[model samples]
Target: MSLARENRIDLVRGLSLLVIFVDHSNLSFSGALQHSRGFCDAAELFVMMAGMSAALAYHPASGAAGFRATASRTLRRSFKLYWIHLLMLAAVVAAVFLLPFIRDPALVREWSLDKLAAQPVRYAVEAIFLRYLPAELDILPLYMLLIAAVPLFFAAIDVAPRLALAASVALWLLAGIFHLNLVDFSQPKGLWYFNPFSWQLVFVCGLLAGLRVRQGQAPFAFSKPLFILAFVFCLVAIPADLVIHLGEYGETTPLRFLISKTSEGPLRLINALAIVYVVFNLDALQRLSPTGWLRPVFAAGRNSLPIFVLGEILSDIVTVSVFGREGIPLALELLAVFVGVAILLGFALHRDRAKRRRSGKPASSLLVASQPEPDYGPETTTEPPSIPDARPNTAT
Candidate 1:
């Protein structure tokens, strides 16, 4: 299998990071990302892309030694994510407690940290175990669980892709049917906002797609009929959501059974895959990706963990600063997005420079076919799989 790297994933993933910041900021500007216009949002893209990243990084393990090596790397990634979650909380805490500019009482409520006084020990333990997700911090726990499952999932893939996907779909169905999810003290129903069991379907789909790419094949074969169907599905979905008033029922809406984000309703999954297919087939995007203007996007995607953490912290800051304010003007929203994106890109570029310096190479634009990557903490290293990671595709 060819070991070629596709920089498009990085570009798309980086774009998703920016969209995520916009979505979580609670500012009216969040609508600019077209999430309200689509059946799926950046969260789906992020999770599925994460699956692909995992497959690319840790799949195709062979003997015991190779298997252990893959496990070691993924374990480090999961552990790094866990501590990074806590570190983000600590940073938020330092800001809330130490910074005199922070006078809003709602900050504690927003972050769901208000109960630390009543049961500090219990809360701390739950947070450490990734059981108690707070506010926007919920997604990482889902990611950690998925990463931890990579070894077993890859094993299943080695035997047969169908087996791995079938098991994933079964688990998703069971989870949705039985209301299965991890406990989150912050929520009324004691469930994570992004349920791992429900979301694994999308992750597994992405894993399969990544495996295809690893085998030097297209993730999804191109066909006129499939492309037309995906486009029509996307085109009709917006009006469909409006017609059903999908989320209007809040918790008990029957339509929620088909479009629920928490449980990753069937429509959401289909729409997400459809979008991936359509976007991947966009020859224009692929052609333009190598342009010099997209260097920032490449950098941000390559340094995703750090960029994501910083984006979250910045979102919190933006949300807090605008708390209790009158409506945020459009001009102000544009400025916030501009500044936030600039900061995130700057950090990414800084990391790239640091990496180049360490590698003893003249600093240059990355994603020029080859470059060394150093995560914000070297916490995302993925060694190539030595085994037959995936069988060649003849009937994608």
Candidate 2:
């Protein structure tokens, strides 16, 4: 079977990134609207959408030829993530160092060599993408590890997808119950924003969803009943959030905690499922129409990595400078920042597209070639299989 291009997935991803951009800028606008449970719900939806997109992108194909192709493709994508991680690390360090020179010395006092040295060697190791870093650090390190783990994850699922998923869920539950924060002594403050023990389940869920989608087993596709059920679930979640107050629940409550994506809880799983249902069932979203105005947003989605990095950097600057202080007109400032980032992302995407066009290669073909093949399959499903890490495909 051919790999179907899920336009709704792209739309969900596009919307998720936009919402996350605002959420990450909580210091700016969203803080003012902290009482808005809708905003919190939106953030949850964004995370869910991200996981769904991953599922759609990397679901495995059937047979040996398809599996090999998928593995090769996954390796290439992982390599690109590695490069992105390296660039982000360098950029973050440079930004931290330069802040003292560009702004007040006090602005970077937290990043002093003495402060950094006080942390364990594991911090440095985690900083290089082996483990979780401090909360103040960017969450990219977790993503790098997740991308690196993709091949192994896929291989394991190839042997027994259900068993692998069950184990992942069990690990997540165990980590919560026992407060099992497994640290690679090589990496410091190993439990950062994206705790591996908690977050791996999200990735595993995505992998399972992808496998289901590939198998045409997803129940949400083009179904009115599924759509209504998803809608009802979303409606129920709102009141449940109010009653449960998920934020108040600590790690002791694994099921409650996981649902709270902000706290890396299981609720995130339901949120992701709801997002998948909504997107998959929306008939209008399945078709891609090449309109001039929308070309940029789609482009931004296509080249999400660099754009996301730039957005983060820009958000950081805005937060530390104007919005970081109290009494700013947050809503207006947020609008301005969002518009500014959107324009910049649009321009960057357009330029990149132009460059590609000039090179006489179809952008879609390049995108496909750049992506690694899906490696999860019936023959290869197991837990933590021995598959080689995917390499980056720079040609795209």
- List clash counts for every candidate, in order: 0, 30
Question: How high is the lDDT of residue 388 in model 2?
Answer: 13
For each candidate in the order shown, give its overall lDDT on alpha carbons: 0.69, 0.49
lDDT score for residue 71 of model 1: 73
lDDT of 1 at 352: 78
User: Given candidate 1, what's the lDDT at residue 163?
Assistant: 81
TM-score for each predicted model, relative to the true structure: 0.86, 0.71
lDDT of 1 at 313: 78
Q: Tell me how far the alpha carbon of residue 24 in candidate 2 is from the true structure, in angstroms, after superposition.
A: 2.1
Clashing pairs in 1: none
Q: Give the poorly placed runs of model 1, Cα more than 4 Å off.
A: 1-3, 31-34, 97-100, 242-252, 324-327, 360-396
